[model samples]
Target: MNTPQKAIALGIGAALIQALMLIAFAWPAANTAPRDLPLAVTGPQAAMVTQKLNQAVPGGFEITRPADEAAARTAIADREVYGAIVTGDGAPRVLVASGASPAVAQQLSAMAQQLSGARPAAVEDVIAADADDPRGAAFGAMVLPLVMAGIAGGVLLSLLVPSVSGRLIGLVGFGVVGGLLSMAIIQGWMSIIPGPYPILAAVAGLVSFAVAGTIVGLATVIGQPGIGLGALTMLLIGNPFSAATTAPEMLPQPWGAIGQFLPPGAAASLLRSVAFFDGAAATQPLMILLAWAALALILLGVGFLTSRGRTPASATTVSAEPVPA
Candidate 1:
């Protein structure tokens, strides 16, 4: 083909790629299962219900049993989990927050059925929100801090750059400032959201720090590879694996299986929990975020230090003494 024709084809291909990505998010990832959704259960015999839930979902979700029925319901209302199971006398009830994503509600409801094996089941939406909220939306558990963190995370990771001499001190300071600022903005947004402020702040800090550290660390290692790596984690793997898109249960086997372990997947469920679950299940997310951030920082520090050591003291030498005047 002629050059002009080839150029036209390449342009078309590029457009097609962008279009596909857009469609991926816009469309329902139907047939996807919950990989590692965190769910709360309440029942007369809590132990039996919790065990049954775990067995029913398998790799799809993590199950938690609150101290009491009220607590489990409150957890769901707060968005601590995707949904909860209330087991009592006549029929089992699935408790979910209205503000949560509808897809999740449905999936959790199905899990209740699977566990019951045709036993009567009912659904109770404890923290029902107004109709204005989007359907199947994640819980207020995530709130503003998480939003801020997400924005900051995306920006920081997207801008990573590598250099032979190591990053400039000014750049490091700038990145830190930027990351913190992102955190602050998210903290501010938390007030407007339904969930409380502390949850937002904590979630935001974790997401922002981990993402930023990831960018910084990757750039220190491979320069250009940082961009691709960030994209792989944040865009490709992160979004799909995230519980934010659909409750893990609704997702088919493969997609749901791995979602919970991935960063975004874990963060989405955890953030929502803090916002909606009344902070019942904040520990797991916090631990994951801390681990990722620490690792990234350590790697970045080592890279910087090693790079400096590799530089010879004679790098700036001026021929010893100017050879003899």
Candidate 2:
């Protein structure tokens, strides 16, 4: 009931929430399962390879038969598939797209090794992660920072800018500049993300806008509680559910599906698509981000309209009310 008690309760509640979130996220990662992970197969004996793979790890791969090794490579580069198995005169080799997901590449490579038996097979990384940080650490590393940026952008603009137009402009400008700067640091300095600088930067900008807009719009509609709600959704729920370090399918049911629908997850997907897949798998994620941004704008407009309507009504009611002695 007292100040100290309230502060203690708040601290305890926050700690518990953080602990639960940690466990929820770590459990899935600690117990990863290969569930319909995408893979491509091509060569003279593609069908036979598929059958063998199916037998080895049932429900592990959602196999696609690319026309040939070339097509398979193209698919890998495009992130259509995590890896591909090519059969030939020599030992069958597994081609992996480590850039998209290093853990997936490792899983496929291990599977390939097991299948080879007495004769060993080669495991090639068709699209490797950054040489400096081959495990794609930088990609995973960016997730939390980006989320924080979005939240900060939204909360700050909502509090500082009085007018709707000013807030909108401020958030947009922040996203663009912040995104480009972050991209330059990650891609240019760290070399974590490869080339195509402008495109990657644009993806970053889009993600920032989605995050900032949503938060700002919520604040406009709901006041201070909106800031806390935004943080909970984007940071607490969104980040852990994103499965950035691991494949979404690898996570438990419902969570994986839920993560895909959130802004953080969508942003992560778009970042991967642009950085390694040449933007081949960008449509869905891009649309998701755009939709969030649109929703934010709509909410802001509605809030403004509602507030204006209420102002006149309150003024009239005050004049109508009798003064007390």
Candidate 3:
């Protein structure tokens, strides 16, 4: 076997690995089903509503009984439940937080309709998706740009700015500017999302920094291979695992759990909370992003120390050379 053959084989192997990763992440999306999605039931007929919904889709909902429709609405706004059913003699009222998840809202509406039989349940979207993009497609689409911005920051900083301090400063600046610009376009100009620009921008900047810092840290420690690894983790694994297009519970086993911890998922959840859930659900996801950013900083520090240690020895070796020949 020659060098060329070895190189070809290695290239083929790398491609195969990428293909497998794509399949692993993408396959679950096609097979999504509701699993323990939260819902609130209220009033005297709560028991019947719960029973019927559970019968319709077993293990699909974690049903809670609120005192009345007002409480149900509060639960939805607080991100306690994805949707709610207020049972009454005339007709059942289904309250959904479409701003949290349009997919979940649509599914819940359908389920309510099925349970109502001939008469359709009255559905109300308490926190609807943005007026411009009512389906919430913009939220899902935003993930790609966030990921790209992070990648650009990481790669460009690493290449253009050689020093550790310079790279860090550059990445931070890039993240802040990029985040603000994105908010201006999405919220200010387009009016796709509502106000609270400062909070939104901060969350976006945090997400970008978390992702970019992780990539830069990995690359500093592992050289060229680190860049590929960063991409594989953030892009291939993080995006689909995020379940941005659908509720996390809708994803097949383990994936939903996995996605929640990733940067992209955390960011998406944070944005949704700020935009519609009144920032009630932001804490956990914010913690996740902060943890990632902290770990990346630690890794970067380690890389800096290791490189500094190697420099003196490298210089000594260069100086001590010229031993006869």
Candidate 4:
């Protein structure tokens, strides 16, 4: 295309990208509401309270009847539910885990007040978020920076490291350093996440490796376009759909579940589990992160083999060339 045409194309492309990004980031927040959010209810009025919730939200909650208040608390601690309601002769008690999701906790508190009508419900936090990030704003803000760091590491490795082995080394090195640095900032300095330093550092490193490795692996296999694809996936799709700022259940269906499978979403969930829930409900997210890291390794292996195959042919072509007299 000519210069003028190129300029016009670039402008249009930029506009389209901006529009897409706005939609991706804004749509979820705009439409945030509980969709099949888990809740446990127990006591004599459990059935009545469940019916009330159903009437109030209409498909908003998936209510489970625990044996009693103790069981309900267990469910919340295990991350099985966002909150629980215990109803009896006295005012009902609402149990919430703000560490799991501050938004959900707030919503539960409001719902309890509404249900109680004249009487105020007692709200208890089963797993409270760190005091430094009571509302989880700082915690939520950390996701983007970690994602950007991973993307940057992957892109730089692809551009600067020509060899597959070298790129692998770079990915590992970045994971270690980047993970430690991130933990130092978010945990040590900021105290946004409450957990042992080593464990949190390890989790941070895993996230970095999973994201960067996937990008590096793609670039190794498919060339430069892979880098763009990886970045777009992490930033546009993964970041927005991650549900890091709120609970996944608060997001629209299918997409909410879908986000949990992505690296950003998995990392966010895993971080919260380890930091506040004592590793409760961490299995799925941990597996997802490992799967991404493993995929990267497999792609790198393919790239290595492909490179090896070309090297012999290249050597043959060079050897067969006529030497200058």
Candidate 5:
């Protein structure tokens, strides 16, 4: 294509790309509402409360009738449910874990107020968020930066480190350094995440490695286009659909569940679990991250072998060629 035509095409493509990004970021936020958010109810009026809640929000909550208030609290603490409602003797009490999801907590509080009508229900934060990040703004803000760091690490390693072995070393180094640095900033400086330092740091590092390693491995096997694909997947789909700023159940149906399978989403969920719920409900997200890491290693090995097979034949052919007079 001529310069003018190419320029016009590029401009149009950029516009379209920008539009797509805006939609990816905005759609979820605009549409966020509890689809099947888990909530536990226990007491003599548990059945009545559940019925009222179902009528009030229709299908907003998935209400589980625990044996009693103690069981409901345990469910919330264990991360099995976002909140619980205790409706028995005196007044109704709502137990919420803001650290698990501030959005969900706020939603539950609002719902409780609505249910109580004239009298406000007692709302207790069973697991409160970090004091500095009561609303979870800082915690939510961390996802994009982590994702960008991982993408940059992988892209740089792929471009600068030619050998697969060198790239592997670089990926590991980046994960370690990046994780520590991120923890220092978010945990130490900003006080965004509250958890055991070592475990939190390890989680951060693993997440970084999972993202960077995936990118590097894909590039190694599929060439330049792989880097683009990796970045697009993490940034466009993973970051937006991660549900870091909101509960996963708040997001659109399949996408919410699908996001948990990706690096950004899994990392966010895992971080929250460790930071707030004392590792409750961490197994699934941990497994997802590990699976990605494993895939990266396997791809790197395959790539190394494939390149090794080509190198010897090319070298042999070059050595056998006769010199020109």
Candidate 6:
């Protein structure tokens, strides 16, 4: 095609992708995840506990069978888990941990009571998050590290995609994970203002890989422009609505309900569940994030079918040879 044709195609294609990313991904990620979180548990040995626990999630957790109340208390202090369970005869009681999450702590009491069949879940939110913190921020805290790390990873990939050493992509991923853990220490122990440091770092690392992979995939599908699109999609579209600070539940209707499907919202909710809710509420959010990641990878594969360069980013250009349909 001539210069004019090429420019038109690029504009149309860019517009199309941007529109999809915004409508399908970024728009929703922001609206569902909450900031302040209430963390706790009912019966530690509640027979159904393990049954529920077996259901794995993408959020953070450390499930342990503590011996007694004292042991559970120590575990919360160590941050072994967000809260603890002390199994007893009637039902069970929750123990709140000052260091855990306050929103969860407050809500656990009422929620626990509601959960118990004979009585209730016997809520006892242990490990209180800070007063200034919002339940939505709890989710944000978990996702912030991941988003920041992913942002860094996206930038790094942009630099490395044009370079000779392709394997460095993997190296970059590893570095992101390392940075996440390191940041966690700084956030958690150092008393970072926003939220817990260590947890944020962990989430940041996870988000880094997911975002980097998406960026990589988009670059493959659209070449250099994918990087720009990724920024617009992941950062602009995903972050703001990603927390309960402005979740759909509080909103009037469908917009609020639909937010959880967005990338940031999914990850934020998953992280918040882990950070404040003892990972109790992570089932769907994890699935949403995985689905988005999978779709991005599929796009990357399609891009790879037609490109010629050694770098993955080159595949994104549309004029390349046909990917075997």
Best by TM-score: 4
Sort all candidates by TM-score, best to worst: 4, 5, 3, 2, 1, 6
Question: Candidate 5's residue-wise lDDT over 1-325, tens digit each?
Answer: 9999999999998999899899889999999999989999989888889999899888999989999888988898899999999997766789999999999999999988888778889999989999999999988899999999999999999889999999999988988888888899889998888899888888889989989999999999999988988988999999999999998899998989999999999999999999998899999999999999999999899999999778565556655678889
Let me know the TM-score candidate 3 reaches against the reference structure.
Answer: 0.92
Higher-ranked by TM-score: 2 or 6: 2
TM per candidate: 0.62, 0.88, 0.92, 0.96, 0.95, 0.49
lDDT tens digits by residue: candidate 3, 20-131:
7778667866778899998899988899888888898899889898888898888888898998989888778889888989999998898888888899899999999998
| Error of model 1, residue 36, in angstroms | 9.5
User: Which one wins by lDDT: 5 or 6?
Assistant: 5
Instruction: Count the clashes in each prediction.
Output: 24, 0, 0, 0, 0, 55
Residue 188 of model 2 has an lDDT of: 89
Question: RMSD, model 1, all Cα superposed?
Answer: 6.5
Flag the better candidate by lDDT, 1 or 3.
3
Q: Please provide, for model 2 over 284-319, each residue's C-alpha lDDT reduced to its tens digit, 9 standing for 90 to 100.
A: 888998999898899789777877667565556646
Q: In angstroms, how far off is 122's CA in candidate 3?
A: 0.3
Best-fitting candidate, measured by lDDT? 4
After superposing all C-alphas onto the true structure, candidate 5 shows an RMSD in angstroms of 2.0
Error of 5 at 28 (Å): 0.1
CA RMSD, predictions in order: 6.5, 3.3, 3.0, 1.8, 2.0, 11.7
lDDT by residue (tens digit), candidate 4, 126-161:
899999899999989899988999999999999999
| Candidate 3 whole-model C-alpha lDDT, 0 to 1 | 0.85
Off by over 4 Å in 5: 312-325
* Candidate 4 regions with alpha-carbon error over 4 angstroms: 312-325
